[model samples]
Target: MVAWLGSYGTSYFGEKAYPKPGAVIMQYTGLSEVTKHEPPTYECVGTRDGIASYHSVRSYIRKIKKNGTDAEIQIFDGLTHGFGLGEGTVAEGWINEAVRFWERQVK
Candidate 1:
């Protein structure tokens, strides 16, 4: 599953209903109170994101990791919310990193 912004929330909310996904890649998502499932997850967010707090993402990832799930996260400096693929910003190579993370999950 690949989700951005608001859709990330949907993924978190629906985790219980669906079979565990192979992996999840989320960007710029807010905090959720839902239970964390064991799945490899890769998440990224800009430090300057206004819509979704970077701290929230960090906390969520930490919680997932504590549950013994493989979780990875990246925080790009001076970036804002909704910077998909990070475009020409400092986060430009994020998509490649995400792909690599997904590949690791498959292995």
Candidate 2:
């Protein structure tokens, strides 16, 4: 099973790619158009993100779950875009969770 992890525009590509993935991990983007056979997804976003609204991401996750897809989202407090790995920030360690989510699918 294939899996993907990306941010912003790349995340959209991961979502729309052919054949889909076993799981998807995205950050700080709010594209909400869900497909019929979406894979399980793990997402993270900052509540204070200027580029992407956490609200939109939350709404997207709801749609994902409603479509019978497993989805999880983390809305970090007081952070913004381009905070890679979120080192020393509230969003730190998010990648570990995303990886665990992916591992579950591939197993």
lDDT of 2 at 55: 93
Q: Report the alpha-carbon TM-score of model 1 versus the true structure.
A: 0.79
Q: What is the C-alpha lDDT of each candidate?
A: 0.77, 0.76
Assess every candidate by TM-score. 0.79, 0.79
Q: Model 1: per-residue lDDT, tens digit, 1-107? A: 23322224444665444445577888987854425544677889999999888998888788878888788999999999989987789999999999998898888
Candidate 2 structure quality by residue, lDDT tens digits, 5-25: 221233455555444467888
Q: Report the Cα lDDT for residue 25, model 2.
A: 82
How far does residue 16 in candidate 1 sit from its true spot (Å)? 12
lDDT of predicted model 1:
0.77
